[model samples]
Target chain A: MRWSLLGTAVVLLVVFLMSQRQQIEVSYGQSPSSPDAVVEGEAGELSEATVPSVEAMTAMIDAEPVVRLPGSIARWNERVVREAIGDSDIRILVAPPGLDEAERGRVREVERATITIVGTKVSGGVYEATADAIPEWRAQFASGDVTTLLVPMIRHLQERESPAVDASFRWREPTAAELDTVTAELRANGSHVAEGATLEGVPEASEKAFPDAEALYVALPRQPFGQPVPRYGPALARTFPDRPIVVVYGSWIEYDGPGAADFAELVSAMFYAQFGTRLATYDYPQGNVLNAWLNRVTDVRYAGLFDRPLPYLPFDPVKVTMPALPWLFAACVAGFLALSARSLRRPQAARDSRHYSRLAGLTALAIEVSGLSGERSDPPLTRGIGKLRAATEALESGLPPAQVRTLLDDAENELDDTARLLGRRDYRPRNYLEGRLG
Target chain B: MSASWSVWLVGGVLLAAAGVGSTLVPRLRARGVRRRVAWSTARAAIDSAAVSRDACATRVAEAERLLARAESIAADRGGVLAAEEAARCAERADRLWRAARRG
Candidate 1:
């Protein structure tokens, strides 16, 4: 059983390690062709245009409707887009709006180039402008051209299509009393309260206020996105009802040290809650040792500009297949149980066979000793030999020891007399023989 | 879950099972061996005692038979003392046999 268990453990460990290796290889984007070879081939084509700076990439992301730009104009735009998104699972690619025929051709070329360079497949269609653009976007989505629309316009359209609540109201900063009331209400309903300027900043604020809170309540500005948009509070509340939240409409217009500290704590707490212990808190744009040390000391991670938290991409689910180990483990366990049962059920008489064998051996030895006395010719000795033989036979047949002992006593007396007649002074009686044998 | 996390979870469960099996299997095997040994020892003891009692009973029966024959011979010779002595010997043997059997 020990061996079986050990074997199963070892097999599982090996299989698990192999599966992890396979997953790592897949995640690292390792292809049949070397990465360097592909990069070098693409580099020559990209040498004519300089790679865009990080600031320029950020500008491109901020300016959503980049109209009528040639694909080759933004060399390595795909790389920039991927870097900006970090590790988000991008299922569909959306072309920038306002593309003429020449620009459209460039966009297609850019898409193909991005696919080739990344060595990963992506499918999507060009975004077309129309008088009825909402229906056009919906049509593209329904036709599966853009399977996962990440554009803010798509979110706005969805909100318009299914208005859950009317949140149209003038913007205003909340008072201290209002904040206190909201915080109290959230606490009453079993929530950890963390004050923030907007819904986007809550993650950072909650991290600062309570680093270990599983759920948190944060203040939401009346116009969080610079406009009277949808009522996200009720929807968020409904979605995470078990994780009750209380939103106080307010604005932290001015930044201060205390506010920044609170934001840092909230971000830390939110990240910890979301990922659990697997993730390490690292400084944003992590490279410098000094920054890492400072971040660690301050317990702060980058919460982003405008006090917005960084995007979080959860790890992909893992699928594992172990064809034989489970069956083998079950078989080993079953075998162990069966063997144990069989061992327990053995016959009691069979187990006691050793005692019978010992008794038989002792009786045979006694018979031999009597014959060695050399009183075979005497009638009394002959009678004693016959009686001893009878007793030995009875013993071999598992006869009662009391009867055998009685017969042995008589045989011993007769044998002793015969021995004396033969002048044998060394002859011992039955009691001494029985004691020595026993 | 991430691939590494999944592997660790499975490895933990397997290790726990292995630990349990390692602890329990040896104890179960020892218990079985001890039970079998105890059973064999008890059987041997009972059988030995029974045989000893049977031997005593046989001795008592032989003594009784001798007493009866001696009494018949003495009666033919008109000797009451010899018959009485044989009867006493037989009675004593019977008593001893009964005591051994009871034990």
Candidate 2:
């Protein structure tokens, strides 16, 4: 039974490990790839590197159409567009001023499309260039919901898109700590971020500031020091409801620590396109899988980020849970000894062995002899032994074993030698050589 | 049909091996290759076989060293992909050696 239990446990362990390997996901869109890109050159704005860049938002806007441009636009432009909000999985549609009823009336058209809104941080610049580029605000707290299904958009849908936000380099100092704080909080919660020694050869100050970033994740932002901002496609397919999708410039984000060699694996997990990374929607059950993957990376790569270590999964073989063998052996030996001592006794001469048995009723013979008149009975018994011995030897060897019995008076003996010996009978009675030969 | 008994019996043997301190991970990895070279090389000596005293001592020693080195490498720089792989390989080697030693 013990064997069966242990066997089952071992088999189960093997199967479990084989089936549940770890999964890792790399988050895209965080920092700019290089510092050089921040400085615009004669060619125009300095191009961002391949790292995913997040656009900033100044204020929220309602999903209402107010055409600022007077030029006649195409039918597609006039049609309602459904666009992604922030990182949320929410979608919003902006209808024309008087077309609210018409939009509701055209069920088929409404089914086909809705107005799209890009919930993003507007950079400071274009407002000063022209009134068309002036910033607008709305009281409605409009945003996207980044569900398993929908993705967020950080910018406008385009034919002729709006220009950049207006702000002078001298006066503009927009540095929101919210994005950094939220990311750090998640890493802390998941055990992915760790504190470690500073490394050399990093090209930016962030290298020292967040020196203890996940190795695989930190290395991503380090690649492509200077170039056009690499593409970060939309994270959602639709304007997801209430989810905040962060759109950073082109930069690599590490799931594991920088030392992780499987960054290629992270890249493989997502779909890449001109826009950005998209974590596509799957079946309802798959959200758990995604979360599980996140948990795995958090654990599997969580080693270096902290001083005190995390406890491992319950992978060690249960400490041979059965009672110990040595204890059992000790108990058995003790019991055996107890029984042996209790049963110890002298050996019985006339019992299992035929030689020992049938050696006359020695006690009965002695009693009968004592009852006999004035007889010590020793001599008679001795005589009986001689006769028995002589017969037995004669039968065994076809010759008389006792020379005295042959030379002297021979007894017609029916008794056996074994009985005579036990009774101590004298074979010779009062003869000159009495009892010598017997 | 219930050869569960065999597992227990084997477990006993394995326990004895562990108690006797013969497990080595590297040798286990090297097993079943090159004429099952690990087992052959690990045998302590023909003379020792007579009493069955650490018949695989030599291979066990070498395998242990390899496993330890691998473990050290893995402990540091574990975040990198290459480092992580090496660490896993080292862990495997150690486990294998331990199995062989136990066997």
Candidate 3:
């Protein structure tokens, strides 16, 4: 029974190891950040190394491309770059999401070559600000009626020319009604907007706007100047499954970017905004556009948070799942090895030959004694004697210890019956024997 | 796939194979050895018991039957112990026949 359990445990360990092996292969075998990796999306390949023509990008516009917006030019990983210019022909013109008015001027001055066309296109499915769109963009900037969105790209030319810029955007308080409308729009677009959800990192002034904390509580902390974008904690996301989370960078106040209401409005506005509208609508958790919208947006660039792809953040799978798989597989293999060693060390057989030999001796004596008595004359006794002899012969043959003992016991019973029969026949008194002799 | 990935996959498969080989092969070998030993013992005993079968016609006929059974057991698989027992029974039968003749 114990061996069976051990065998079962080994089998289970092997199964566990196999399961983890697949995950490990996926984790190490194919890196998600490889720029040359061609992922077959519903549209054409999502990871085109060379820039594609304008017509090609336009053809994929209706395919609902999923873009990865890097927090800044410096923070751009291959994954971010691969998603951005995978389909577009134009060169990337990058900047930090949140920038002050002075930094904006510096950015504009640094790139005088394309100053009129400041807003470059994102890769895959973003709006290509063509020669026709460039005039309108300049006109809008001059008019001051709308805040034009900046192009989402890596490698800012301004960073090469001027000193490093910090993330310090303008701040504004939003009304509670606007937050409600934003939440409603998110819900319509298949987002799980937890109403009255306790939002961490909200300023005290905006805390009253969200009074009740009935649902998932998300912490939208400010992203420091050059650090990577903030992602929702895996622990927090696991706690409230299916709750929508925003991977916030800086879409709020000047220091804080936008208020909680403003942040929500920006996220909801991205669903309809020209560049963000092409984002493939994902159900609930997978489709949360808050990260994608906030990673590109900053206060200096996107004064109107709703209209610009430049104002949004980027979100991706948390770092936890990919790294832990290799360790788990290793542990499972170790356990399997331990169990197998234990199983091997145990003895296989414990049958003793001397035990059967002893039983045979006892059985041989019983047969001899039974034959010595005159009980063989009786029909039943004769048959019993024959059976005892046969049993003795069976014992001499190399039966297993248990079966030999059982046969010996049966032979002993027959011998006892033969002895009893002899006792009864020999029960004559001494006096009666003397009288018969006289 | 990366060259390291092939290394890992091959390494894992080899590890699993080694684990199975290390634990299972020795036990299977021991069992085979035990069975062969039992068969050898049974065959020797059966040969020894066959000599006395022609001494007494009635008693020796029973010994012959037991020896036949033992031979059959030894010939087939996994019945070595039983064959040895049957041969021992034939030896006992020979002893009983000699005792009956002396009585």
Candidate 4:
């Protein structure tokens, strides 16, 4: 928890510092105030020269160089990069829904910034080297929207939520009452109007006012018959050819290895998704996060007093400027949390109190069950106690409870007494002797 | 026609794969660590896992060889301690040989 908190603090600090590009640039010997600092030719000193380390000849031969056998022994002495990185995971970009103005700018900024950062982190993001050079690299995809989407997509990866219409305003179409009200209000200023939903479309009608050229067609689609998959994509495409159609669909998010077989399978699977009428598909791949979110969804409920949008403040989703620092800070925070969780999960001899509690319960159970017949006039009390004790011992030794019970039963008949004791009065002593003799 | 083609193609490929896997399975098994003598750890560790009747004929022969050597050494003026040591060693060896052979 402390590690996660520290990680969060570090991420916030990164975000805060990154917000001010001035200080962040200084780390890489660049001054944000002077753009010329980035120029390779301009500098106080020419450049840093590579330095060579000198080692003693005797130390080289005498030293028992430890070689690491991967997945087995650790070699602190041997410091060499592994020749191959195991199992490269295929990265899927799932863009967050409906980017606010501020977020969109941040997206663009990150896209530009990734060109520099991607140069260092994973040289060639499997997409291309020099993020700017990715254009010349792709055969058909050149608009660079894919690269633009990757940054925020990777940073703010969330499971797909139900696609919803953001806002809807409704009015009874061509209502006589509504039209009368509109005309009464408009005619007071000496204006006339049609009795329809067109009263609200007054602002948009001046551009398409010719009655003979175009007819007002207000039609709603009938319910689909067979497949429930929304046919709205092609429907809208036919209705409005010039305007672009955006279709959204829910998808399972999971990680897939980058093997050609898996890649081909995914490609083939996507071909069938066309019948589902999805305009464009984006892989969300939040298996790790979705499980956690699902758990939260099941267990937790929110009652925040006000909206605390992560990237935005004050007036919501408006003419806002995007800041790059916050997103970077969030990334650092997430990384820190992940690392802390992974690191701290290491096992110790620390036992859970619940485990000890369970043991104590079973011990008490044994004490109660051991001498069950002791208080009564049960003759086979010692045998019963012995059996119970044996079962308890088996339990203590970690045998299955059922097996212990069975074993206890197996020893039961051998311990039962048929004859009565001497303490029992009422002419039972003679009878007890006879029984014993028999 | 398409369905049948797909079925036949997948079937042939799977059959070929199965044949190839069977051929390589033995080699892969052999590459692993060898088993111990007390119990079967992987595959064959001892000459024979199964023991016949009271004791193995081969185990008796080996035990006899060791006993014969100890006898010859004792013949050339052996001390009480050496004789006792020899007796203990023979007993342990014989016990192990018998147990292994029987097991």
Winner on TM-score between 1 and 4 is 1
Model 3: how far is B25 from its true place, Å? 6.5
DockQ of each: 0.02, 0.01, 0.08, 0.01
The fnat scores of all predictions, in order, read 0.00, 0.00, 0.06, 0.00
The deviation in Å at residue A37 for candidate 2 is 40
> What value does DockQ give for candidate 4?
0.01
Model 1: per-residue lDDT, tens digit, A385-417? 555655555455444455456556555665666
Write candidate 2's Cα lDDT for A1-438 as tens digits.
Answer: 433433444554344345345346432322222222211132121122111111100111123222111111111111112332323223233221111222223311322122321121111112111011111110000111111111212233222343333221011122345334434543443221222211122223333223344211211121121122222212110222222122221121222233334432333233122112111101111122223333333332343333424434455343343223333333333343343334343222222222112222322333343343222233333444333343333333322223223312222221222234334354212321233323
lDDT, model 3, position B20: 75
Q: Rate the local accuracy (lDDT) of all candidates.
A: 0.38, 0.27, 0.38, 0.29
Candidate 4 CAPRI category: incorrect
- Deviating ranges (above 4 Å) for candidate 1: A1-438, B58-98, B101-103
Model 3, A229: alpha-carbon shift in Å? 40
Give the CA lDDT, 0 to 100, for residue A423 in model 4.
34
**Model 2 interface CAPRI class:** incorrect
Worst 10 residues of 2 chain A by lDDT: A134-143
From the highest TM-score down, the ranking of the candidates is 3, 2, 1, 4
Q: Please, what are the lDDT tens digits per residue for candidate 3 over residues A142-184?
A: 1211112222322232222222222222223334564455445
* Best-performing candidate as measured by TM-score: 3
How far off is residue A239 in model 4, in Å? 59
